[model samples]
Target: MPSPTAFQPVATAMPDNVRILSFEVGHGECTLVEFISERQVAFRCLLDAGRVLPAALLDHLKSNPRPESPDLDVVVLSHVDNDHQGGLPGLLEAGISFREYLSPCLPAFKRLRWLFGERVNRAVDRAFAFEQQLRSHKVAVQYPLEGFKSRYASSRVTLSIISPAARLIKTLASGSPERVSALVSNSPTPLQWLFEVDEPVNEDSQALAAVFDGRVTVCPEDFDTFLPGPPGPPASSLAQQHSQGDPDFFGNATLNDTSLIVVLDILLDGVHRKRLLFPGDQENWTYVAAQHPAGLGIDVMKAPHHGGRVYLRDKDEDLPGVYAWLRPKTVIVSANGQYDLPRASFRDVLRTVGGSLLCAHQRTFEALSAGAMKQPTATSCFQSMGCDRGRGRSVTVTLTADSESADLPACVQGSGITGLAPIVVLRQDVTVPSEGLLRYTYGELDRHATWIKDRLDEARREFLNKLKKTRTAFDAITEQPLTSWRVLAALAKADGRHDLVADPDPVLKFARSQHVFWCAPVTGYRASPESFASLPAAADFNAARRWLKSIPSLLLIVESGNRFPTGTARVEILQHADWGVFDHLLAGKLKHPAPVIADEVRPVLLPLIAADYSFRLCHFNYPDSHYDGGKAFLLLQRDSVVIPDLLSPEWQVAWDWHAHGSPFKAPWKILAKLASEQMLAGTYLQTPYGRDALFNRFKPSTTTPLPAAMHKARWVTY
Candidate 1:
């Protein structure tokens, strides 16, 4: 949350010929490739839609004037992996059409299993469904088989299928039901599927090559299996030493090895200018090097398998996965913490080889903070290499046939060690505070702070005015409500204020006053078993210790009876910090040490409200309503918890909460909203009162050289 010492605005240098946008789709893959000619879009190709479509891509499609016609020139489903092709259905649903749809065909039985009520692979199911939909729309669908070629007249671009040799397709057509059943029986988890050595569907993935002018880019959609024949005549390239590995390879290849290996090259007068490679989740580098020696030593490469490490034969013999002997200058990882991807080994290898990294998702930072990855270096690798965990951030790589170098954003460039892209704040400028307390520093943001304070005042005044103007009534109808009464009893036990059980009206009065409404839990009607289903039964409390791990402060209310006569109720409040003593009590899991007296229901009512939970109560004045007098209405609202740690990833979460108007204290949500608006307007860094104002309010300080735990959680300024 710092700006560069000196702001030097530089226009993004995009190549005229080709542009690639690798989306941040959270452990999925979705890329858009645009072929531009004379500043006009000659063709648009979508490479491997991710598990979900990125909003940017959807917006791009919707922006097309020709909704009735094909807006996209090509859609390449790298393989049937759900992460790669799941978004295709969404694209089809959006009414976006493409002239050509290239993918490997699933075996007939595999595609038809869904119809017979069998649990088919989700990837296969989606692919088959999409194919049917495309055919219905009169779109041309073709398998990207080896030696298959197509030429586009308008773009003068030639397309060629360079992978999944005809033999591999035939092997797939002869379904491996026995192998599939064995794998299914093994019950490999989703994460295990990525490393499974014998995932047949991935073996049949397509690798596509595109040629326009003097530039060529190959997209291998997870096609990493090496057959016993020549794929085709290898293209010409520089003779370079392949990455070294054990020559005697004996282990089965991972599903990652099935990744489509694709290369990008620029040539003028048959002279190689630039060479880049994009190995899709591939880990078997020894075989790829032996097969395609011409495309070694890439200038840029998207680290395969979301930057996962590869085990050659055994876990002890693990190697950095994406290195695969084809080291590149810049490595981009498109993944998140969901799968614990973009591993630390990837970072160590990059540092050793002097390569830069660009991470697309912020959750990667969370993984680092959670100790899922470890790095032992002087300065943080995330800072030096450049990372963008910013909201909706994506990495764009542009290449031109004329230039020998590909263009990357300044933040993620390979040339210099410029810490972060355009932000640099000295660590000495920060202030660290004790836990659970936040210190806000205004500095240059005095005016903004004052404005915010005034806005808070105005908002409070407005709320009071609305309260005075509205006619509201509360009827606590607590008759025949045993479940809710049990829940309230559990809540009382959890708060360690069981004395309130005998007199619960004080809690109701406190709730009606709205002083603690900021953190109070809001219920639609009344707390019920169905509403809090995850809560264990109160009788199971002692046995459900694991479920009591982390419980938030809450308010429980039981309302019952008819509307005409008003309602009767009982209310209780529970509060805890760090560790909750009776977290599982409300789940109906509390174990009583002694037997209870069935007929001893002494539910006393209190006239006075506790000072900790309530403020002065105000009466509602309604001239038109008959039920507006004396009846106290229990109005509960949800509030955002204040996160005192600036380095914590919760700042991003708080930002998101503020987006949908999650109720929070005045200045907190207001600051978030203002920061978001400024960022969207492209003025967060340009103005005097920039986003630093918002961050300053939440900023917690640490030492100059942040410890491992703090480093991962926070991005340092300088």
Candidate 2:
């Protein structure tokens, strides 16, 4: 094992629901959504009609395919910017197709779409992929409607339109830029959630909200306004055909102002589901902010126009700034890294949202700071490549439901938590196979027959000894209120399941008995055994149950970390029952009734605890990459209120990094090691590392920690 460092990359996989597959293009990119149903299918939200999809994206999608044959569902065309949809033509070339076409229904973009109208589509008739395949399969877009309540293999997904409201459109076209500015100026950040009065662009941009499993995510493409172009010459008569209601386009109906906005309330069997709001550059959040609906607390948000300062009023700088309402746990700002999102504006938004900020292309140095993307860098993921390099007006987000919590990193390298108490399960199950000493060497079987027989005999004896345990084991429950005496007594008589080690047959029998829905990963997360380390474990309802059963043994007991850039402690004990509760365990999951816990008899509990660890560390240091910068405590646990200077003095990054750029952090490795050791032990360890120092100082905790020390100091009213 190598020394853990913040720069060490953690492995991340796409969620099971839908994977957002984006490809690098010239100046933009293309992203496709896939739904895991009876088969794996791509949701074609965009199509070039006959042009190319980004080469990178197309290649990745083809090579990394879904398990079941997936079909394309909804096709989206977010306003016809050439860079945005340059790959629409590629879907056909790739031999992939979908059913619906999500057009902006905008008159401006409509002109370009008209080029592919009935006659044009017929003329280019070399059997365009998406539409042609859809018709053949008896599936057709035909026209746009209200919304779709789509479900694939137990993972439910939905998309709601929240922009282009009638009233806002009328106002934008009839007002001056200043008037539009005034209206948008006071609007809350996460324009989709802010509502009171109306802003022009927020009203027009097509805000599309997506719900995966139970989490809410809204991608308001460029909700923040930064009016481009000097007011174009007044539209001609033909362009003005529909100007009866309003005259000036920017004044009355700024294209950016005509977006759609919506919030989702997803639930199954009456259980409230996760929430998400999509505000398509609606200048102002009209309905969301006012209601503060469950979905407004979206977990993932795409920065409006890559955090353009124009969307925010000049005054917010003095206050909070644009990251107010759309405080996504993970915010992906798609912009040309070198341009857009001024440094000042970026900092302002950080202070406002107080969540992780993922700026594209490392545009501003601030993007790399802990206050922004603070978590350990994730590069092993196939997706992270070129992810930071967002193409102009090209960003894709996919919401999937399989194992909703951001999939645990394939391997957590620098998490500062590992090697806890001797793991009982690991010790018992692990096996070290011997080198090839088979019977057949040169025509091996006969040559090494004696050696092979001896090895087999030894293997059988070891296996038998390991399984010869009768002291403690699992058994069937024949009573109720599992915590009661009746069930406890019967537990002893039942036989410990010997088959649970490999076969899920026993687990499935338990699940069906409880009437629980066995919703497992269908496509994206690679639920099939063929995907794991050649595990060859059969994948099905039963297999999923078995995997769920082993979670208690597999999960690490460290404070949960996030993909978001926050130093707050999101700790969790995977053994608790909450682990299998789908997206409900995610902080961003809406306040829906938690899904029914898995079998009460063989009950499991996965409690994720959010704690404040700053009290323990209470210091900071400047990052070596940003050498001289001061380091204050960058992390604060959720729900924790951190007082300033709880420690003897203001902290900086690691002391070594400040004194010597990168090489001097030698001591840092030691400190990090100590931290990892304590974290791995969770809270149950005796004589823990940092615990002693903190316990002696602040003595703060949930119950009997400490009382504030009284001190006298002269107050100066500067």
Candidate 3:
């Protein structure tokens, strides 16, 4: 038996340098920092673990062993938001130990409970559970204070807490915890409970809330009244409605505003240094910007709130001030399409502020590997030791003290680091299949067939195992079978698979029928095989033809193979009797003038035309042919165009004579001309450059023949 191929490690050698790795966890932030000493001793610090521990981070933990013990130097849970701290439980379960755990939530939980009232006890309880987990792992837990600094004496790496002032905590704790509890108990409804705890605190919290309010547009008016207690009837009405649906919205925002913003300064041999500013979901940028320490320029900035639009002020005034203070050259954001982040507006703002945007979720390891192969020096660390493995997106940066500042790559420069090499590593798996048909033809055929059968059996077992897991998960979610199916259908749709509704299984069919109003067809067409199968034979034939044309023609061709042309011809005969059967048959179906249709339908149509009219469509080099025409028509339609210059006096006569004077006028010429017009129209409609040029040339004149010649030229020879 052949050994299973192993995935090559992208980076093997660990140099005595400073490096940062940002993992893509879908609308979350997870960063790992490594400081290696001259003697190769290393200290690792993690900043948040995102909502889930990505497969790549877990792989990293398994692959990279610590010199002394399998432990991280520090783990900073910057905030208690699910996106930031949700992966902690999984990391601990994986036996990845940490020396110190730092977070503001652990120490300020008591005060946070008082500010939010007893109704927010669920969030508070989760935080307490997290703290207990850290303690169970024998990790040192510390609360970040304003001006609190932790220094790794050996490596000269210092992390300084710069936000959530001590006074802020005191202000939040000013109201009596017992008074809030009593108010919660006596409240008529959960909505009233919030109003009861709306007693005013210090001016700092109010100012922070005011700053946040100006930025976040969708925050309910009730949340504002509940926090600052501005007397208004509209607020009361909103509070009543919101309490029935989402009561904890304001509490979540308040928790984010109190995130521990930190500045990490790394010094190499006392002279060479680098700084990173990690503001974990801190939306109160105005307050943080005002308190910004002078002479603190950041090399890289992990943008707050996953580059959310809410962090940017209405007029772009606050962001510029913040950027001016920190002067970050590279802004890293961790986001995915699911969350609609980081916002395009925020990215534009970053670009305007002269900062390069590097999104973690957009970079894949396979792409990085290809990039490394093309530019070895620029992406030197991206070399794979065996094929890459993981399901995450990540960007890695390696900085060396000895490397000359002038010799640094553009990426390193963009990140504001003077002497660094940046390498982006993504989580991907590369597999190489076996080649050579000789082995299969010889004695290996039987063995190969048996091996394939065994593999299929294994796959079936694995699929069944997965189904079992799904069933268990569904059972845990709900007791009712129909409810489980509906929930699963919704989850599947959210994951971008709408075909689940079309499954032939009785359960899925029932689920689809029940949710037919909400569950639209994935391909924008309503007809399906099951639907057609249930119809009468006479109606089914018509429905089937419509369904065939509605789907992608390429899919039909691939699925039916040689049967496609016959099937399509039968449908074509039923649809049209004359006017060049195939052309007329496709005209109505591909009427949209969509390039996608042309691209898919043309390749299959061309071959069918050639096969059906063998004598009429003989190769160009054949003895009977007058013009150079075979598959050349394909090229003419796609590449060559009848520009206005060709229709001018210098070339028109020659072209006309050459085209019309042919002994046998080519049938392909008509097809080619139609294809060209379709191609041009598609291009003009799809592209801005083509559209602009087309509109610019649209002048009102009877003698103007250029537009017709360029876009609507007819084949006179055919």
Model number with the top TM-score: 3
How many clashes (backbone atoms < 3 Å, residues ≥3 apart in a chain or on different chains) does model 1 have? 24
- The list of candidate 1 runs beyond 4 A from truth reads 1-15, 62-69, 108-120, 146-162, 175-278, 297-299, 311-324, 362-392, 401-718
1 or 2: which has the higher lDDT? 1
Model 2 reaches what TM-score against the true structure?
0.35
Candidate 2 achieves a global lDDT of 0.32
Tens-digit lDDT string for candidate 2 (581-665) = 1221210111111222232211332222222122221211211122121221122122333232222222122121222232111
Q: Rate the local accuracy (lDDT) of all candidates.
A: 0.40, 0.32, 0.46
The runs of at least 3 residues in candidate 2 whose Cα sits more than 4 Å from the true structure, single-residue gaps closed, are 1-18, 22-29, 35-52, 64-71, 107-155, 166-233, 236-253, 261-283, 286-288, 291-295, 310-322, 342-344, 359-718
- Give Cα distance to truth, residue 353, candidate 3, Å: 2.6
On the 0 to 100 scale, the lDDT of residue 387 in model 3 is: 15
lDDT-based ranking: 3, 1, 2
Give per-residue lDDT, candidate 2, residue 433. Answer: 19
Compose the digit string of candidate 1's lDDT tens values, residues 258-358: 34444444331233344545556554343333233333566666766677655322221234322434457767777764455665455656644556676
Q: Quick one: best lDDT, which candidate? A: 3
Residue-level lDDT for 640 in candidate 3: 31
